[model samples]
Target: MWRAGLPGGLRAVFEGSPLSSGGSPRLLEGKVALVTAGTDGIGLGVAEALGVAGAQVFLSSRRAHNVQRAVETLRGRGLQVSGVTCHVGRAEDREKMVQAALDTFGAIDILVSNAAVNPHFGPILEADESTWDKVFRVNVTAAAMLVRLVVPHMEKRGGGAIVLMSSIAGYQPMRGLGPYGVSKAALLGLVGALSPELRRSRVRVNGVAPGLVRSRFSAALWEDEAVREQALKELGADRLGAPAEVAQAVLFLVSPLASFVAGQTLVVAGGAWSRL
Candidate 1:
């Protein structure tokens, strides 16, 4: 028997009781995420974060061994994960990567274009043609092409998130970085140009610019004591950044929590440059 009023004339209606215990909705449950060059470093970090958040993450790198190793490592952690060998600079490899994700996860809800190359470390003017081409091709062009391929699938799902990995060097070129910095600068522009068009299709495009992240890729910069000290002085952070920190920012950008965020580059450089 239920009463129509409670206590002193206040109406009380009890049609059905609410459930006392229910699982909180994960931000990315059942979602599919694809991350390029994800076998190690920041790419792998992003992949792990997405997988932990309940997304089936697909990762890839140039070497088959690395792909297998990463897949096994993530699987051992009980994350829904898979991988394949892919060189982002090659068209066939890129196609194969996309197909692999489709085959395993059905659809891609998040894309992290994190593959980049910095073959040369010298003045921009002295950079060889081959070095410039390689840097631009992998760092800038491949990212744009991957976005082109993934956007169609994202549209099919109504909307999705895309994160382009840039660098603090994009805003303030680091000494001796030359063409690599230029390529990163182009990524910032790429996000700006594509964000509006991507938004029309309900797909959000954003960028993450990290500064002096400690990884095998940037070992030359941070591993040297003198160089590390100078960088630290400029950055004002006593510690260099870890890949996980960058990965967290990428997770936020692609999550429902950042639904209103789009067409912007979030700098995860630990206060290296004010503009970045």
Candidate 2:
């Protein structure tokens, strides 16, 4: 006979359960994500974070070899991941990227527009027309276009999140980073313009502005000992920010926890440039 008030039956099953995993279930389970320029640096870091959180992550780069290598590396870590080659500045390529995500995961819940190029670094007035156009096309127009392409697909899934990668230079123009900085500033405006429309459709639009991040793309800024020391002096952060640090802030903005967040730019610059 069972003792009075003894935990038994379903209670016994619960008490003796091996079915429960020790860690909490992933927050992003069953979601799908697309990260542009995800073959390296900050983009790759964001992709890895989303994958670890249980999202089926789709990444893209301009080079086929990089795409293959990134896909292999992420898969090796047992993440649900895939990749394709895409030049974000091209319309056809952007369409192909969106289509690839749909084809691979059925729906996309998160879109990280992390691709940008700084072709020229000099006085803003000294920049040639071609340089200006290239900077705007890749750093601003491409990000906007990618978001436009993903909106319908995200809508199909009832709602989704979009993160645009801006830069600290957007808030404070750095010398010799003229065109690139202007383009990043434009992204901030883009986020503001898109958020109201997106929220009504249950989608969220956000931006991340990182300062002095240590990435190959920004090596010219910090690779020199003298330049690095100067940047540290100007910026409050003693050390340059890591790609992964930026990725974590981005992950939070895209996650369900940020469901109520929209039309906001979370500066991940280690208190370098605080407006308020």
Candidate 3:
């Protein structure tokens, strides 16, 4: 049920799009994808990757402007995409996001819960109860609730793919990112628990644990020259990861390429020491 091409006035975007550049591959053509926090950084990268693969992407962010920009960028690439301003922590917003996908794409086949927060940067002990609450509410709770909203849509379609945004911090506790890391660890657990049940729905649940990537979200970890150097040596990586790298990992899981792969978290970190 995919639209074949762009409408009038927008044909040039697709004509000049990377899809025509031969750099784009169409592994997910006709699939419908919903990516939360799909405005920038890893989220935007993922949106483009999925769209380039042939999925009609529905992306969202807290800000209207960001959503608009992302939608325009994707369309300019000749990808069929739309956007909604959403606060993933809100129930109303979650409902709207799901409904928008169904309304626009006709069905939902993929979900990437990539929205996350790191409100606290200090030691876990000094972190207030409110900080913990907010972290779990957005990073963990909202993700789970959003899944609940989409599972039925996926079920109706006979099956679907879901990717949660976990992190390398989940496997090894990083000093300043304790609570955030803990929440990501919870996601790893969520993938395991949800997968077994989602199998009946024919839906597959997976996650990606990325290392320190070059994004505004992780600027604190890498922006400083001295700190970046120390962190790189500690992580045993030569350079930082790019959002495109992470997006490709996501693309594989959601695509038919990763069929039979479920409940497993792909570690996208570059030698960041993540086992067990």
Sorted on TM-score, best first, the list reads 3, 2, 1
- Give the number of the best model, judged by lDDT: 3
How many clashing residue pairs are found in candidate 3?
A: 0
Q: Is candidate 2 or candidate 3 better by lDDT?
A: 3
Residue pairs in clash, model 1: none
- RMSD, each candidate, Å? 11.5, 10.3, 6.3
Model 3 over residues 1-276: C-alpha lDDT tens digits? Answer: 011222434345544555433555688887999999998889988898898888999999999999998898779878899989899988998999889888988998999999999999978999999999999999999999988999988888889999999998899888788899999999999999999999988899999999888888899989999888887777767777878778878989999889999999999888889875
**lDDT score of residue 261 within candidate 3:** 99
CA-RMSD of model 3:
6.3
Give the Cα-based TM-score of candidate 3 against the true structure. 0.91
CA lDDT, candidate 2, residue 269: 84
Select the stronger candidate by TM-score from 2 and 3. 3
Clashes of 1: 0
Give the residue spans of candidate 2 off by over 4 A: 1-25, 274-276
Candidate 2 versus truth, CA RMSD in Å, comes to 10.3
lDDT of 1: 0.84
TM-score of 2: 0.90
What residue runs in model 1 are displaced by over 4 Å at the alpha carbon?
1-25, 274-276
